[model samples]
Target: MPQPYQTQAATGGGKDQEPTIIIGIDFGTNNHCSDKEKVPSAIYYNEKGEVSWGYSVPEKASPLKFEWFKLCLLDEGDIPQNLRNAAQVEAAQKSLRESNKRVVDVISDYLRELWKHTTRNIRRAIGGQLVDLSRFKVIATIPAIWPAYAQIRMLEAIEKAGILEPRIAGETILEFLSEPEAAALATINDMHTYSPTNMEAGDHFVVCDAGGGTVDVITYTVTKTDPIRVKESVKGEGKLCGATFLDEVFQTTLRRKLDKISPDAWQILEENGALSRIIHNDWENGIKPQFRNTDQHWLLQMPTSGLNRKRTHDQFRFSDIKFDAKDVQNIFKPTVAEIETLVTDQAKTTKEKYKKEPKFLVLVGGFGRQPFLYTRLDDQLNRKKDQTEKTEVLQGSGAEPWTAVCRGAVIRGLELSEDTIESTSRKPNTVVSTHHESITHGFKNDFVKPFKTMKTEFIYSTVTTPPERCDETVKRLCKVRWSSVPDFNSLPTWINPIGKVVRRINYDVKMKSNGVTLDFEVMYKNRVMASKKIGIDYTCCGSAVNQFHDSDEDSGDD
Candidate 1:
């Protein structure tokens, strides 16, 4: 018979701890659910208006709501007026001020509540077949290019929610990773499962994680050995253009229309919570709205007879609004254009710089979930094809896109928590002393001096030496600006070698509004050598790049 539980002496010297069970949390705008549980991120308000949080409770007769508390923590500056009535504003402020709460706090609270519900539900559902929540480790998938402040906020939230604690009933350390990287890992795993073909390392592929809030794309080159040298891949971020932008367009169009109407009615709609509910309901119910920019007219599919459905004394109308496909396309123009620009720019750069063409663009996210969105992208990619035939878009679903990131993150968590993979994260050893703006002296001149450098102190262990070859392929967990560059010459003699031309990498890392973190790799002798970590102050936003140095002692080859 299988032992119910096994105990082994701890490898790191402490008493044996419980085996870690990794749990992935995808904190989305709509709801929070794990791959292993039915619990959702939701809450309800009672008759007296007192709020109670959990999944739908039957005895309370309260309606199911997802992300109720999370929406309360958004930066007031980022929220539109329609989303912020006087009451909501107050509630938001209250939530924001509590423990210096930030976006992650809201996410953590929502997640903690979800976990609570999961435990309860499992116990009730299957007579406690599921393990308790305390034994599980959390792996959260965050934005690709988050600001440092935002990252700290998320960390603080995780800490407060007890994800960082080792208590029996509390969560262990939270493993936060980039959502795009996680998705790429998932794709790689998927490929491994389906295609057993022998692969080589340095094989490159572009990963696109298009979700509700952002479309995160990265180019990853697999690093593996001969006969199977495809373990490692190159990854790069495209841009962030997700479903939230669509909602913004719809909301803006509606807001403009509402602005033309009487403010009193608008206020009533806003105050009564009808506006948010209507938009939310519409989006959830698959009702798309279109707008004519020139005429300022909205084409909605609503009953002409139920025009007064907002009145207190009117008969109930069965219908709401209707949106045409064209209007949907128009509203999504900006977002679509943004993605197109990114793809074109990335494809052009890869061809010119790396001499490689991406065969496919994997589109996994909530926005990518839309079939029409994929069609739009296909049209754009085909229009811009440069004898490369076509840039295919591999799309996923809304119901799964958001969660896929978390799912991928969990796999990473399990790998990390089990000590199978070592974290090669480091702090920045340099600082930027001078800032120079790119200057094009001549009109229509396409020339650009688009790179910057920083001053940092290097830390090196006696046994660890910088890679002999270019560090371009070695990935590290560092916090540098997406477009920021680091001068390899800046490394102290103790860490880097002399007289070899070092390679510099310029990337526009995708980070959440909270904070910035970079995960990059170095390529040396057909293998990864070392990884670095650098912490950036969250407030500053600028271009970041890495430079190489060759000392006089080893010069003359170039």
Candidate 2:
């Protein structure tokens, strides 16, 4: 069932809820984006106040591009050195720590920069009249592999990014859609629009999202055709087998080749900007996607800027560098095997539900678009006994494979609004499932404080204000009251004990009441970051009011 926004106002008898602008943000490990628009998941810094992110961050230049920054967000350690940026995330962490910032903080900063550009682009694409930030809605895509804790922290970053409306007023609703699931939604919609063969009712398929950071797999069983309904048939699976790993392999191969010539030459190549440029140019256009088997060798020309023809053997006649097919196979085999494992596992696990096996496997993501990788997956599955049937293994048809995740997310955002409209248009018994988990977040006030006989003072601060007050009583009529003076809506999420605002917070609160029901949430920084609320009710004490407690006063900075 759609989790009620718990908008305290929704219960107050809304004939119809107002609609908001919908946008989807695909925050990938290697690529971050807003709908169809994308930018790199990178940040660059040279001095204390000098920083840039995404495409703006210069590569193969004097500045620093924080590589594999998103990988550091993972809980596990033992991260491959090649994947950990040339300057290293350790240095980035150290620099950020000096400024009282953490990984999420840096990530949020990058996202904020992206958000500003996105809104501007939206206005240019549409119009300022239709593209209003005040009514913005953002849906973020997360890897299914991210545990609950990681997702919560990602949510914290998403909140800090300033796109989400922090207060609950139906003005802003933020959703977290799984990466593979979002891709699945896009696939289904495309299939519907194009009317692909056997995209029939009851068809089961798996969506494999092979992005630059992680490989995530999700299996879905379609239930409806006219409106195109599907449910996740099995728990999603993922591994750290993304396109970034291939880049790491390429780096390792280059290092080995350079080392064969002379240690000094390899060190210079690694330290200077030359190697990165060669890798970037080759991966984006050359050998990375084109390499199919181990019979061929790839030769790269080193930058000519700082080289002597004789100092570094035949390996460096100003530019010649070589790695054979065996090296390429070694680099890709492990990562490719890992992805193949995930897809196979999802298919096997979903067999009981789908009866035979998944009818199709839809691959989507930047890495998923690789022709060689797709062939490998097809071969792997075909060799398996269960996949003897002619199950289709394909990428998205209507759009580039990389855009599916974001496009699907946007479609989902639209569907959310559409569902609300459809439900409102008809009666309660219409064709809609009440047991759907379509909602992204659900808030409940699990924490309650009991009141005694005397009226107690309660201070309440919403995402929009400093603090407000109302008498504690068993029964009362209430709503979130705003100040006439109008405090800024962009208030910091947390305040110091002395009550000084530190940073700007873009958050929302949803409060509802029959007789004074205060339902809302606020974020507090603890270097860590559910949905819980506060409730107040009278506890029977007869005449001995002094013996009973007025409130369950237990709280901490979270």
Candidate 3:
């Protein structure tokens, strides 16, 4: 039943309120949400001069190609190494700015078109009801590796969308859930369908999510105790080592081929239609139907017919290019080796900690969709399992790894609504200043005499001066204001006493100087304290002071 959106009281009591449309937007550079419940990371312009998605563009249409455009914008540096054309590069730069224009701009314009096309079936399947666009809660999934500052920027962009207007529900409103967690959840849901009590205590489950930008892993121990908890022990994380990386490798291979065959035509293709973008788009789609068959002739499909006539390039044009699967294998060997090593190491680390062999390893993501990838993974895991009898490799469809993550996030969100922390029954998992002032310095042997103990006020000054410079000393004092009394005596006296309060603290300290530097250390009336050294640098004057000391001077000479 579709319900209206409403806010729940902080006390946790709420009725059967309307289910505000909860939309999960997975902003992968290679994929975007295309439908109500489906998102493909691709965008295409249609014949109507409008945008379309998840489909090939028609020849009659004036199309603008966008693949992993969201991820492209995150880069503050030059364009990707694969792209070298001045014109296409300029166009891509312009598209990136347009894609990021306004959150709503993308949504209402390009994204909405994709959504309408893709979600037509989903909406029909779901009882012929349409989403209440006026009041939907938008939840986006972001890469966990993004810096804290970057995550905040994404949130700010979403807020500017004006969709979550008026009373925004905290946590439940707009949130960024980790991608792998969502994928793991989706996998668990599938696994549970067959065996409700399948994963048991001490059973280890390894999850690999290979997406547009990164490959992330999460290993967990499944327990069948009362609540059936799954606890995460480790997270294998890295940037999109998936299709995008492969695109780069393929482009380099083509570039080398072009150089060998015809450099003149290569320059033309470089200017007009670089095969890099086409390969990148194809790779991101999780299929290279042509690349799969080594014996068959794969089309380079460049824009110019004149250049095609002159270029008898190896892979650049269909000039009876005779390259075997071995050639493609050799080209991708580095990336394949890297992927294998990362997965193997992550699995080994988890297995070592578990003591027992892992029962199942679940692979998900765009890269996981490759039949070849599955074969390779299976072989690797089988070899490892050969040494031990307990381990097994369980295979799932690679076509939709993100589904698990989205389902899991939704389930998790529902769990939060009921005030339950653990959904062990549903899935096999257990998921989980101030400164002081005041300073005292003491010197030993010979040089220690001008002032046994030196102290200055004004905390946080690290300037030093000569002993004769009394005029250089500056005093700093701070007043106290508190609703309640603070225990200043309990605080350490070694630090210059400021003032104390029940709720806060304040302090003032002197600075450090040469020949017995004055280091101002302070303790506030409250619980706050800090130290600052105001003194002259003796190194400039050739004095070798091992440590600086604070001087107690009312004033210091300039």
Candidate 4:
């Protein structure tokens, strides 16, 4: 039902065709951003059946408001139990029940609105008909610890939202990058500038993406210095402890104190939506960011008349409730401790693997900039007496901390496009072809022995749990064979430790999506050596394996 757009090289579009543009989207639980500026991840449906979202949502609480719906994409078991009872989650669940909409539908609706704004912003920046004529390559960031199914659901929502609606299958590529990876890409350069230790190849660093609804931590080992390529040192870990939890804690504490002083005042505020307004305006926007462990005081004015009961306490006046440094610190303690634990664990993992602490611990995200959070992490993690032994704590430079993930997503897309262009330029004379869908899984092999033929067996399984080996649940999909082998004498050779000459030919077996079927290709040095298309009896599900082996020994006919 979706309309297909023309590819960059499609006929009829002449010299007026614009170059492809890359866009990065970070869809967070508390906020969403396509660029440097973020909008709150809140949506509201008015009584008149009109919808408003993000910054347009009303300041007053409404029964139709929806927040924290992003986590609803995950299976119930995947969500942390503590977050299940959060106010935003409860409101979203209620909204879904009343509207008879699924989580994907809600997500799609929000994304559709976001895309509209993103396109407008793009047109304003570049001008002309560039937006319509240019092919778009979108890189969306997802939490590093999200399961594969959640990632797939996110892709589906993006497609349904019309972001990829007018897309020519493989031409308009939509790729997913881990949030920590994206954040690292955007902030690592800044880290290099501020870090005391000189960053170099093989040096490891940890990226802690402490956002609104989740804190994800990952360790990366730098592979290249110039262009900055890194490989994951360990599997990333994450928890539901984020800045939003601080808001909840503060609100809960306020409610408890208010009820103890005057239950009538608390009831009046709740009924009139004054409580929600105070939390959003005074706490979330003001006190949460400004808290710095110093003895500072904050006053929240009570808007209801029921608070005129003349309550006299050091922390409370007749018309307002007072919050001191200790009150805000208490609200931040649990959440900050959780984040500290996550970062410490990642540092410990890196130390165990590489025999030293991470060279730097880079923090990025909306919450990553909080003075209290950064101060606590630095004090706890970098307390080493020797400066060289300490892991340098670096905050994302200015607003870079807030937009790092989305910006990093764009950087990743550009890198991929550059790689593609570079590869094509190297083999200008060769006819390069791409399948309808992008490659998903690929395996590389090195050959030291000469062979006339090579055969690869493709196997698949539908079981929920992956098999350790090719067992009963695993079925053979098909076999691809390369019959005419390239010349071994022309390939490069290297000497082994035993002084034996070895010819090493590296090739990758890549599988591309083609609706219900799959197209497989065996590539050698970026050149397609062999390819095969196979039909599928089942939809694309579960895991796959490509077993490679030589079909025949060297004939010695050379």
Q: What local lDDT does model 1 show for residue 205?
A: 57
Q: Which candidate, 2 or 4, would have the higher lDDT against the true structure? A: 4
| Selected candidate, larger lDDT, 3 vs 4 | 4
TM-score of each: 0.52, 0.62, 0.53, 0.67
**Model 1, global lDDT:** 0.43
Query: What root-mean-square deviation over C-alphas does model 3 reach?
Result: 15.7
Per-residue lDDT of model 4, residues 478-541, tens digit only = 4456765677677677776677777755566666642213456778767887776532222222
Clashes of each: 85, 12, 84, 0
Give the number of the best model, judged by lDDT: 4
Pitting candidate 2 against candidate 3, the one with the higher lDDT is 2
- Candidate 3 lDDT, tens digit per residue, 1-558? 001122222233343244344556666655554442324455565446566656553323222555444543333332234332333335445664654443224433444554345335445544333342223455466654332223444554455544344643233355555566556566666676567677766677777776644566667666543344455555545544565566666667666766776666566665554444455554434234234424443444444435434544534342322345665665555655666776777678876776665677777765655556656666776685357644455656423423333233232221111110111011211111001122232211111112222222121111222122122221112211122223434423232234322221223322332111223334334332444432322221211121235342422201
Identify the runs in model 2 with alpha carbons over 4 angstroms from their true place: 1-22, 34-38, 44-47, 55-99, 123-135, 145-156, 165-173, 267-272, 306-316, 352-354, 384-388, 397-558
| 204 Cα displacement, candidate 3 (Å) | 1.3
Give residue 208's error in model 4 in angstroms: 0.6
For model 3, the run of ten residues with the poorest summed lDDT = 415-424
Residue range with the least summed lDDT across 10 consecutive positions in model 2: 1-10
Per-residue lDDT tens digits for candidate 1, residues 339-449, read 766665555565566676655666665455566556666676567545654556666533332233323222211111111111112322221111111111100001012
